[model samples]
Target: MKKSLFTFIILAMVLNAFTACSSKASKGGGAKLKARFEVAGMCSNYTFSVIEGRINPALVEASWTNPQTNKTYWKAFGISNPCNFPSNIKEGDTFYFEIVPAEKDSKCAVCMAFYPTPGKKLNIKVVQ
Candidate 1:
């Protein structure tokens, strides 16, 4: 009976460890940047043509105007499908969003092609 109880305890601990690991992994074990942006316009190849070569024309270009500095910071999202575009947002609308690296130092060509200009290899999600 003692041996059986010991085995059961060990199994329970293993199960708990697995559950914790899986939950953390699914939640994206990383720090995410949360910010708000005012949609400036849709990004096009012409926008990045000189700076970073041709790019995915479907990207959304947005900017955050710093209240303190009164400067605007720009970034672009690689969301290509028009259907996936957030229904609540429109051009010139300010929205909250989060940016997380797709992977550590991930340099996705399609997403990061406009580097040094306005694009980066990160996953962006609207925060509703």
Candidate 2:
């Protein structure tokens, strides 16, 4: 009986150790998520569309090109050039902006959002 009790104690200890290790792993497991992409270059009422979205690496870099009209949409993201704001895109111009995600699918959803800009507000699918 004593031997059996000792074995059980040993088994319990082993189980507890495994459980603790698993808990630690879980605490450090998942990848970091990034913020969704959005632009307010167009009318506050109009919404921008995501042409293509894929994870490149740690940084999410996206540029816009008006497919239908053959124009650049850098200003949509509040940038003028590759590293400039307004993207030199004038107001009321039909532009396309590629929305890139920060982190991968482990966390953030590949979604889009638009903040109201002056007279026009970008359209969003949200109920509210």
Candidate 3:
């Protein structure tokens, strides 16, 4: 009886572990969005602007509206350590990407000069 009880407990623990892992994987694991690499200028950190998908408004740190066209641009900074921006993609190239969390100690060096980019940045990875 004790052996059966132990086996049952082990099975339950394993099932629980799998359930937790699956939940974490699906929570923030599937947010691919389409964007174009629009370089604002030399000083801008976020050059990838949304082209075909919507980003969480809360993640938008900076935005610009073109008065003539009435088009709005959204920008987010990409974390470089874990995510290396694709080299083949050039300015104005459209690509798919997903938002990711920046590491606790991650940092990107930049100038203090003002640039037309969202002050808020969301770590993102280029998805094929």
| TM-scores of all candidate predictions against the true structure | 0.29, 0.25, 0.53
**Candidate 3: where is the Cα deviation over 4 Å?**
1-29, 65-83, 105-114
Q: Comparing 2 and 3 by lDDT, which wins?
A: 3
lDDT of every predicted structure (CA atoms): 0.41, 0.35, 0.60
Q: How do the residues 1-128 of candidate 2 rate in per-residue lDDT, one tens digit apiece?
A: 99999999999999999987665433322222222234343322232322333222222224445444555533222221212223344334343333222232333222234434222112112111
Candidate 3 clashes between residue pairs 3 or more apart in a chain or in different chains: 62-118
Off by over 4 Å in 1: 1-34, 43-71, 74-83, 100-117
Q: Best lDDT goes to which candidate?
A: 3
Ranking by lDDT: 3, 1, 2
- Taking all chains together, the TM-score of candidate 3 against the true structure is 0.53
Give one clash count per candidate, in the order shown: 0, 14, 1
Better of 1 and 3 by lDDT: 3
